[model samples]
Target: MTPAARKCLDQLRTLLRPASVATAGGFRPPSDPVTSWFCRAVGQPGENLPQWNGRPMIPILQIRIDELPYVPEQLAHLALIVVFLDMEDLPFDKPHGEGWLIREYTSTNGLVPLPEATHDFKPFPIRWTRVEDDAPYWEGACALLNMRALDDDEEAEKAFYDDFQRYDQTKVGGYPTVVQSDVGVEDFVFQIGSEEKVHLAWVDAGIAYFFRAPDGTWRWACEFY
Candidate 1:
């Protein structure tokens, strides 16, 4: 067997499945005949995406809180949490809100669906699925984040970065799949990968990490290779 495949298997076998749940999201096919993913969606809009100046923000991620495989207590009361980015330029060098925003809704009742996107803004619908056994798959994650390292670091060092990886998909509730240094505190909420199917790209294949601040506000950072 290929060495990489064997290494992956070994990593998987050792990962502990904690009670945390993970969910994956991806784009829906264009011909599927529906614009709204009622439970949740990615690019497509529900209530209108807010705007700055005269330009509207681009909807990138949306979650129907109660619909999740295991609802987080913090979000259980909300109908959806939506993430929107600047339509043209994403702010990597500046503070989080300079280019993006997150909004939470308690109800969707009597809301009007947004008008069809123009040639300038194309909407991509999304679908969600519950995935099993997700967790921070490597001890390196803890060390990198300044958290306490694994018990057997001296022995585990031999396998560093070569054999194991955390579940690195566009997901909620697992250890973040980072490309460079990890960002934010341990109050990790979720990470959004570059959803190529939805025309979402962060610089070049970067993913944005979301965190919950002590005061209950949300914060974000991006990492790329």
Candidate 2:
């Protein structure tokens, strides 16, 4: 990795660490995604991403530096979460298909220890349930979001799809969704009023990336892309 990229990666990891969570204080509305907090903490220049609704939107990273306790050692062994957006329809000459990829780098060596996948895929760090289309994945995510309230399940699901249709017209692939059935389900759930709600983060090819909040809640950050 180049020195500049390495520096940014280090900054990102440190910014996401639990210790840094305490220093992350802001006054964004709850409707905002978790990426807002990350943008606030890291202060990275926003990229010109896709637009949602009539307004443009940018990429956002959601991170909770407070809710999850940190172990100094764990920081040394961290996973790099990389999500690929809108790769399904690259130009005819461009390589296409697949949207998300993850690689774990050791702070000790700053290198990817594992061999790369045959054609250059980094499959470790996250067990992703890849969905070829966005609708189903978004539906599942919306359901997980309001898991406690089933009464409005249908409406919630429709709203998610409608929003995506209006804003994200591209074919989205490699979108990852994790539910309670996954190994770390319990840890991913937000405890509220005797109800354990599952957390979810979904990103399209353009703007809108969701992240886990400090209180174990889920939030999304969106801007004109």
lDDT of each: 0.55, 0.25
TM-score of each: 0.66, 0.21
Candidate 1: tens digits of C-alpha lDDT, residues 29-49: 445322233222333345555
Q: Which candidate is the best by lDDT?
A: 1
Native-to-model Cα distance after best TM-score fit, residue 77 in candidate 1, in Å: 2.3
Residue 147's lDDT in candidate 2:
31
> Of the candidates shown, which would achieve the greatest TM-score relative to the real structure?
1
Residue pair clashes in candidate 1: none
Candidate 1 residue spans exceeding 4 A from truth:
1-48, 93-97, 116-124, 137-140, 143-155, 158-165
